[model samples]
Target: MGPDDAFWEDGEWVSWDEIHQQIQYKEWRAKWPNADLSLVPVFEDLISVAEDYFLATGRHLQVYGDIGELYAAITYGIRLHKNFAQGSDGRLGNDHIEVKTIAPMNTKDQTSVKLSGHFNKLLVVNISEEFEISSRMIDRASLPKTSGNILKIRWDDLA
Candidate 1:
């Protein structure tokens, strides 16, 4: 098992979109302590706009990055830092976490990590076209040392 097996459950993933749909006719889980339920509607709006835009034109909007980041924050109880924050994106409890978001439309099922980023852990969030989200959270110590501005991690490796 990987270093994150205990927390991530062998890369087991959950679909917030599916859950949201189930409660569409009702109320959202406002008390999800770690998550900002308000952002849910905004994210959904973005999704709807993207879908509409795609249908209108043959182009895509690449909005999944934010969606992916938000997933990591909510799932792992990370409190995100302000915009343009250097190094890590947020903190999970007392540990800093670097979040890498994988866009579904990408030709490859992988993500780019910043070598210069600071964090105690690395959280990679992958979002499917259906908005089904999944993630791989690994302790920083588990990552191999490399020299470069960026590093790549494939979904296969995480799984």
Candidate 2:
């Protein structure tokens, strides 16, 4: 209905978690009453707040909210977390998400077999890339292995 509305409707969205600083849990709760905070507006408000916080403090904030709620928000380019969700899926739709299990392992190098999951026919991306994997993380699941750390994961399983 307005120029700004039109701009948003057609605009490309950047992930909120990628750019925001930590949110004060108490402040966030005070501002967003449950059942009333729509995804886009919340994300926009958080980004704006984060920008200011970063300018004044020179640091990014980690937001605290239900992971499921946050996951649902980022699909439209907004995300809230103390740490950005590490993964390539973007948490949008099955087309870009997947669930995998590690293969069994012995005491050799390390190998894994991706079990089942859903993802867009496009390439699967790793979310953990943003986080540091500990050296002590020694197990089949410590790291995921696809043909090249990514592939076109199956899509029906997510449902």
Local distance difference test scores for all models: 0.74, 0.33
Candidate 1 structure quality by residue, lDDT tens digits, 1-159: 333322333466445554466685245454345566656677667767766787788577877777667776656668889989999999878899898877767679888888778888998887766656778899888877678878888877886
Estimate candidate 1's alpha-carbon lDDT, on a 0 to 1 scale. 0.74
- Superposed model 1: Cα runs more than 4 Å off: 1-27, 30-33
lDDT of 2 at 4: 34
Q: Give TM-scores for every candidate, taking all chains together and pairing residue i with residue i.
A: 0.72, 0.27
Q: Model 2, which residues run further than 4 Å from truth? A: 1-37, 63-117, 121-147, 150-159
Model 2 TM-score relative to the real fold: 0.27
User: What lDDT tens digits, residue by residue, belong to model 2 across residues 1-159?
Assistant: 434333333365444442242344434446544422445356556545655665778664553122223433433332222344434223333334322221111122222323343323222111222221111111224233555643322222221
Which 10 successive residues of model 1 have the least lDDT summed?
Answer: 1-10
Candidate 1's displacement at residue 53, Å, is: 2.4
